[model samples]
Target: MTRILFLFIDGVGLGPDSPENPLSTLDLPSFRALAGRQPWTSRSETIDRPDHVFRPIDATLGLEGLPQSGTGQATLLTGENAARIHGRHFGPYPPTTVRPTVQDKSVFAQLAPLIGTDRLAFANAYPERFFQHVEARGRWTVTTLAARSAGVRLRREADVRDGIAIPADLTGRTWQRLFDADAEPISEAEAARRLVALLDDHTFVLHEYYLTDKAGHSQDPARAASVLESLDRLFAGVLEAAGPDDVLLITSDHGNIEDLGTKSHTRHPVPLVAWGAGADAFSSCRSLLDVTPTIVELLTR
Candidate 1:
């Protein structure tokens, strides 16, 4: 079986090969080597190697203004033109108009039947506050709602405590810092090991890191650098752990943190980076809308 580990790194976009871009500032050897010793540039979009493929896909969806997370992530997860359906780019949460698409066509819902729920997982864990917020406002991000509609069990604090799921930071450091618990930070190698073990049981596993988007909006250079630095370690561990059959798909919803110069999202093309056997599976994609369908097709096949 072709096991896939889908990595959704939020708020990343292709920018100029300049110091202003945090990605350019990140001294990540593993990621840099995957980029063929280049920055995340338009030139990198042309890159195609056996084990790595770096392609830039449009995030704007041909609409106006900066692409927002609600529509962008919805489009990526459902293969729907969410921006068009909402008549414009929507924000932090999905608008009422496009919520149905999120619930119905999300990759989680689409693949549940093909691969069985037992063989799939959404690897991010939610905190108690998130559940409380949902109860208070009855809203959620596109990914969470989609998984719920598909009957995919969303991981919780217990899952995190037991090491079955990871927090949004890719480590439990935030949990330790925030809750003042005795939790030690999860190492990148351990994260990679846990993810690989999940792949052993699941045909597909999805882990979302949304802090990139928050850091982009905060426009804090120090914060953005910290987030990128941590992710580089986790990514390096993932690269070291995953093997030939373990297809790795790393992508983003829209562009944000890449350019801290702007407090708003940019009209940049996000990268669709793939490794292992799955690299070729996304060769035809050029936009966020192409991601979910391609992933679903690969998993179902």
Candidate 2:
């Protein structure tokens, strides 16, 4: 059986390859190898090699002012035009109007019945504070809502200590500093290896990283560069660890870190980089709405 590891990076888009973009200024060899280009931007064209596929896909869902995460992530996970359904692109969290769609139509919800909940995993671990937030307010991100609907176990700090989960930052340092997590910090490459190792037990594993978006919003070039560099290392490790039977899918919901000119999301297209088994099937994806359906088809076919 083939396995899929979906890496959902938030708030990244193709921008101009200039000083405003750390992607343009950095030396990320792994990204270059997988994407077949440097500083993937508007000028960058699609690369369809025999072993990999890379291209920019639309994040703006037509009726958009600026694409927001709530609708964008919902669409990415559910294969539905969430913004259109809700009559606008809405935020950092899913709106009440879009919650039902995320709960029912998300890739996890759709796949659980076909592949069994046991075969699906959301690889990001949560802190105790997050669980308390869930209990107190009941607000959830699109990804968590989807996973919850499917009865997927939301990983926790113990999962990280057990080597079964990866932190959102691709290293435990942030968790240690912020939450006083007991897990020792590991290198980004080691984090990638841990994520890839999940394939042994799961048919589909998803890891979400939002610090890119946070850094982008900060308009701090150094912060953006640091996050991108960590991702570069993680990507290299995944490529090294993933076997022929595993497919790696990388994409984002909206654009932010690509251009530091503003503290807002851009209308720029986000990159979709796919490699390993059944990667070609994803070549048809042109927007956030197409991602979940492509994965469903690939996994179910």
The C-alpha local distance difference test score for the whole of candidate 1 amounts to: 0.84
Q: Best by TM-score, which number?
A: 2
lDDT of 2 by residue, 1-301 (tens): 8799999999989888878987778898888887775557777779776457898999999984999999999999999999999999998789999999999899999999999999999999989988999879988988898898889989999998998998888898899999999988889888989989999999999999999999999999889889999999999999999998899999999989988989989999999999997788888888998999999998998
For each candidate in turn, the TM-score is 0.95, 0.98
Stretches > 4 Å off in candidate 2: none
| Model 1 misplaced regions, further than 4 Å | 180-183
How many residue pairs clash (N, CA or C atoms closer than 3 angstroms) in each of the candidate models, in the order given? 0, 0
In the order shown, what is each candidate's alpha-carbon RMSD?
1.5, 1.0
Q: Could you give me the TM-score of model 2 versus the true structure?
A: 0.98
**Sliding window of 10 residues with minimal summed lDDT for model 1:** 41-50
User: Which residue pairs clash in candidate 2?
Assistant: none
